[model samples]
Target: MSNQTSYDVVVVGAGNAALCAAISACEEGAKVLVLEKGPEHKRGGNSFFTDGAIRVAYHNLKDIRKVVPDLTDEDAAAVVMPDYHEDDYYEDIMRVTKGESQPELAKQLVNRSFETLVWMKGHGVKFELNYENQSYEKDGKRQFWGGLPVKTENKGIGLMEQLFTRAQELGIDIWYEAAAVELMKKEENICGVAVEQDGKRMTVETTGVILACGSLEANKTFRSEQLGDEWEAAIVRGTEYNTGDGISMATAIGAEKFGEYSGCHSIGTDYNAPKVGDFNKPGDIYKKHSYPLSIMLNKDGKRFVDEGADFRNYTYAKYGREILKQPDHVAYQIYDSQVRPLLRKEYDLEEATYYKGESLLELVNQLPVDKQQFLKTIEEYNDAVQGGEYNPTEKDGKKTTGLTPEKTNWALKIENGPFYAYPVTCGITFSFGGLHVNSSGEVLKKDNKPLSGLFAAGEMVGGIFYHNYPGGSGLMSGAVYGKLAGSAAARYVLGNKKDTKITN
Candidate 1:
C-alpha cells in the first residue's frame, strides 16, 4: 500500500469487463483508475478471445415486466434454454456446482439478464438483433436462435475495441500491462489493488474497488485441483491471460466460492489450428467431412464423438473425463476431399490437405482394422434414423446431448462416396467457474451478504445461468454487472447505505 496512491475507485483487469466498469464509474462521476495486465489496445485477455455475445432478460424484478413488456413471472419462468426449464437450469447448476452457488444471487442473475443487454446496446455496442439463425451476414438475413444478434464479429474484437477506446475517451485513467498482485482490503472491505508495471511496484488505491479480473483457467493449481489429474492435458481453447489472480486474492480475503465440484464450462482438447506434432496436418483446418464418404477412427482404429453434428455442440458436451479415456488420450478426425482450402490469404498454407480418401473404401482400406467395422459405424447410424429407432445407440460413439433421441434430425446421409474426415479433440473459449453473484451483479458471501465497498463483475462473478448458455451473455454480464457495480459504488461513495449486508 502506497501513501501516495488514491482515487475514488480502482478497477483491476483491463478487459471488456473492467473497461465497462471504468466507463460506468466515470459516468457516475467517480474518479476511476483501470489496471490491465495485458498489452494496451491489443487482444491479450479473454475479452479479446471472447466470441462476444450477451444474454439477458432483466436484472431487476420490477423492470422485468417492462423489458419484455407484458411478461409475467410465469411467462418469465417459462422462457428458458430450449432444452431445459428455468428451475431445472438452476438445479442442474447447483448439482454440477455441488451446491457451491449462492441461491439468492442465482435468482437475480436470471431475472435481470435482459435489462443488462439493453444497457450495453445503449452504450453504442451494436448487438445482433435479428430473430433467426444466420451467419455473419450484415444484411439482417437471420436472427440468432434466441432472437438476438450474433453480437460479435469474432466475439469481442469490435465490441472490445469500442469499449477500450471509449474508456480512454471518458478520461478513465488506464494503466496497461499492469498485473495485479494482491487486493488492498481494510477489514474485509476492498479499497484498491496492488499492481506491478514495468518492473515497478505501485499501489493503486481507491475508496471502492471492483475485481473484474476474469477467470482462473490459466491458473495451474486451480485447474489441477478442480479438473483432476489430467487437467494439464486440456489445452487452453481461447484467452491464455486470465489466470484467476483476482479469485485467489478473494479467496484469501474470506470471499466464498461456488461451483468447485465441477466446471461451469467444459474444456476441450481440440487444436484450434494446425500446429506441430499430433495427428492431422494443414489440410484439416476447417475442412468439411463426409461420413461414409470418409472413415472415422481414433489413434486405435476407433470412433469417439459424433463427427456429423455441429462442432460447437460437440465441444459443449466433451467432459474432461472422456478426453482422458482415449488412446494417447487423443482421438483423430479423419476426412476425405483432398483440398477444402483453409485458404488463409494472410500467411502460410492457405489450404490444408490432412486426411484424404481417394474413395471411401480406399481410405478405409488404409486402416489396419476390419473395414466392416468402420462401414458398420456409418451403416448403424443411418439405420437408426431409417429404422425409426427412437434412441440411436450412439452418436459416432459417445452419448452426449448432440442429436437427441427424438430421431427427427438426420441432416445428411453418409452414403455419398469419396468421404472425408479429420480428427478434433475438445476445447472451449473460457472456463465458466467464477465468483457467485446475484442479478444486481453484487458479489456475495456464502451467507448472502454483499461485501461493503466491494463489487465484482465479468468472468470473475457467477450465477447468471448454467448449461443453458445465452449467447453474448458473458459480455452482457460484464456490462450489466459492471454498470451495477459502478452505480452501487457511487451510492457507497455518496453515503447512501450504511449496510451493504442484505439477507434474502
Candidate 2:
C-alpha cells in the first residue's frame, strides 16, 4: 500500500471497464488509481476470459477500416461483413430484451459503440476480424453472422494487457490484490474507498469514484438468492474475484438497483470444467457453442429447447438457464461427421469434454442415458429433418418437420459414421443486475436522484441487459459507459459544471 491517501479518481476493478475509466480520467487531467481484487496474473475480471469481440455499428468497409486500418482490399473481398447500422443495433437490444431494457441506456450503448471502439484504437488497442468465432466460410466466401464482426487482437487477455500498459504509460497507478471492501461516503456524497491489500487495510480518499468491479456470477450465495437454487451448481466462466463487492458496496450507500436481478449472461460449458476459469487457458475453450449445429438431448434422451431456434450468438446466453432446468442439469450435444466440420473452434480443443463413436447408438452408450431412448430420439429427429440447402452463414431455414421441439435451422442428419457428443453444464458469466446509472454514467439513487461523487460502468451498471444479451455487446457496453463515467467523474472533481465528452 502507498502512503498516498488520495487521488482525483479511484476506480475499483482492473478489467476493461476500470482501465477505460482510469485512462479517461487521466486523459482529463485527473490523478487516477485503479484497485484490482486479484493478483497480477488474474487481474482482468471476466473481460480477460472473453474473446473480446465487439459488436459495433458500422456503415461499410471504410468505417471498419478506420478501427482496423490493416484491413486490405483482399480481406474485404474475402468476407461478407455487412454494415450494421445504428438502428439495427438498437433493434437487436430491444428485440433480445423484449423491450425491457431501459431506452436511454440502450440508445447510449448503440450510438456510442463505434466511437468507443475508435477511441480504444486511438489509445493503442488493436483490433482484428474474429475469424474463428464470428464467421464460417462457405462457397469461397466468408459470411459473417450475428452482427458482431470485430475483436481485440489476441482476444480478451490481449485487450487487458494493452489497456494496463497504456494506463501505466499515462502514469495511472494500479494496486493489484487490493480488494475494495467498502465505499467511504461523506454524508450523501461519495469520497473514497477502503481497500484491503497484503493483509493490510487503508482508506484512499478521492474526489470521485468509478465502480467497474463486475457482478456476482462467482458468488454462490448471490446466485442462489437472485438466479435460482439450480444456479448453485453452475460453473463460473470468469474471474472468481467478482463476488458483487462493487454492487453491494454501492447499494449500501443508497445506489438504486435496476434491471433483471434474476437474469444473467450464462452459457453451456464443458461439464467437467473447473469451478473457476483457468487463467492459463482463458475462457473461450470451456464454451460449447456448437450446440446450434447439433441435437441437444437431456438426460432422458429427449430434446428440450430448439437448438437452432436462432443464431448461436442470439440464443447461447440464455440456453444455459434452460440447461439448468433439465434433469440433473445435464445436457448432451450430439452430432456426426457431416456436422463435425461445422462445429466452432472451441469444440475441437484437446481439453474439450466430448466423446466419439462409430454410430449414434455407440455414442449414447458412452453417455449416461437410456440407450433405447437415445436411439429412438435420434431416429425420430433424423426422420423429421427436411432436405434443404445447408448454409452456415445465414438462416437457411433447413429445419425439421414434425418434431415437438423443431430444429428451425441448420438441420443435418446424424447418419454419417463416427458421431460425436459433448456433455455440457451451465456456466454463469455475469448477472444482469447492479447499480442504476444515467446516460452520463452517474450512479442514481432509488428516488432517481444522482449520487454525488459516484459513477459506474461494465457489468456493475444495470438496465442495458435483461432476459438475454447480444454476443460481443458486453465489452462494448463496458467501454462506452466507462468512458462516460470517467469523464463525468473527472468533471465533478475539477468543479466543472459543463459535462465534457471524452474523445480521441
Candidate 3:
C-alpha cells in the first residue's frame, strides 16, 4: 500500500499553535492533518508545561468576561483589576526585549491578542482568572499584578485537552508519534511533508504546511550552538521532542531565520526535577518562580541575582541563566515564615527540594553550602532591607539599601521565624530564535518575500521574544499567529480570497 494521502493543510507539531492552526483551517473548509512528534501523553510542546496564563490585552472586567463568560460578578467586584490595554501590552514586549523585537510582529501580536483569545473561546477553549499564578489576597481584595490576570481552565494541560477535544470535534485528523522530518517542495512551493511514524518513514502530500514544532532547547548540540557554551548543561523544561525539527526543515527550504538565537525562556526549577518535564505534574508545577519573594543564594552562600529586582513574571525567565552560571549550576531560594504563606502553591509540592529551620544557621547547615558564608549573606541581606511597608501584590518599593545588587522591590526582612529554602537549577522552556514569518503567517525567504505554501506559528515562528520573556505571553503569541497562519494557509490551498478572513 502506498503511504500517501492528500490534505489542504499539514500542521507539524500538536501543541497549542498546531491545534489552533488545524482547527482554524478546518473551520475554513480545508482538510487538515496534524502530525505530532511526541506520543499522545507528551503532546502540547512547551505549552503543556506552562501555567497557561496567557498575556493578552484586556480593557477591564467586561473584556475578561468576554473570554470567561462564567466569571461571577462577585468575583469581579472583589478584585483590584488593572486594564492591560493594547499600548501596555506592546510596551511590555518592547520593554522586556529592550525594543529588540520586530516592531511589525509585536504590533500584530498585541493588536490581535484579545480577538484571537476570544476566537479560541469560541472554539471551546475556556478561560478563568489565573488565581494561583497571578493573584494575591490583599486587604480583603484579590489584587492581580503583572498585567497577566487570566489563564486557561485547568492550566496548561487543560488548555491542550480542550484544544485537542475541539480539534477532534471538528473532524481534524491528528497522528501521534508522527514527526515531520522534511518538507517536500516543488519549485520553491511546499507540496508535502516527510514524517516518521512508528519508526517508519512516510510522505503525505499537502498544499500548505504549518511548522509549529517549537524550538531547539531540547537538542544539546543546538542548545550550545545557538544559545551559549553552557546551555547544553541546562535542563529541558518542556518536551525532549522539540529538537529544532521545524526550524531545521523550514530553513532547509530557504526560510529566513530571525530573532535572538542566543536567548530563550529559562526558569528556576527544582534541582532534582527530571531532565524533561513530568507529565503528572504539568503546567509549571516543577518551576520555582517565587524566587522573587525570596533571596537566591549560591553554593558559596552568596547572593547572586537580585531576587526582587522585579515581579516574578518579569525576572523569572532570565534568572535561571544566572543560576545555571552559578557554582554547580545550582542555587537555593531562601525565605522565612513571614513570606511562607505568600509563596505560590508550587513550593508545597512533595517534589520540591525544600528545607526549613527555625534559625537561619540551622537551615544553612541542612543544605550543601558554605555555612559561614550563608549565615553572613543572610545577616547582610536582612540588615540591608530598608524599613518599608511590604506589599506582595505591587512594586511596593520596599528596597534593600547598600547591597551589592539591591532587592529593588518586595524587600522584607527574613527574620520572622522558621526559614524555608529550595534548591533550583536552570530549566529552559523554549528557544527565542526561529523562522521569520509575516503578519499573514507566511514564512519569509532570504529576500524577505513570503515563501509559497509555507506557514508557521508558536515557538517555531519567533521574533516576539528576546533576551528575556514576560511570563504568559508565549501562549498568547501562539494563538494570535496560529490563527493567522491557518487562515493564510487555507486561503493559499483553496485559492479563495473572498470566502476567508485573510487580507492582502
Candidate 3: residue 253 lDDT (0-100): 83
Model 1, global lDDT: 0.54
Q: What residue pairs clash in candidate 2, if any at all? A: none
Give lDDT tens digits, candidate 3, residues 365-423. 79989999999988998899888888888888999999888899888888977998899
- On lDDT, the leading prediction is 2
Candidate 2 residue-wise lDDT, 315-378, digit = tens: 9989999998899988999988988887888887888989889977777888888778889999
Candidate 2, superposed: residue stretches over 4 Å from native: 496-504
Q: Which 10 consecutive residues of model 1 have the lowest summed lDDT?
A: 275-284
Indicate the TM-score of model 1. Answer: 0.72
What C-alpha lDDT do the candidate models reach, one value each? 0.54, 0.90, 0.88
- Per-residue lDDT tens digits of candidate 1, residues 181-239? 88777776776778888899877766677888877766667777766656565555445
**TM-score to native of every candidate shown:** 0.72, 0.97, 0.97
lDDT of 3 at 56: 91
Q: What's the CA RMSD for each of the models?
A: 8.4, 3.0, 2.7
Q: Give the winner by lDDT: 1 or 2.
A: 2
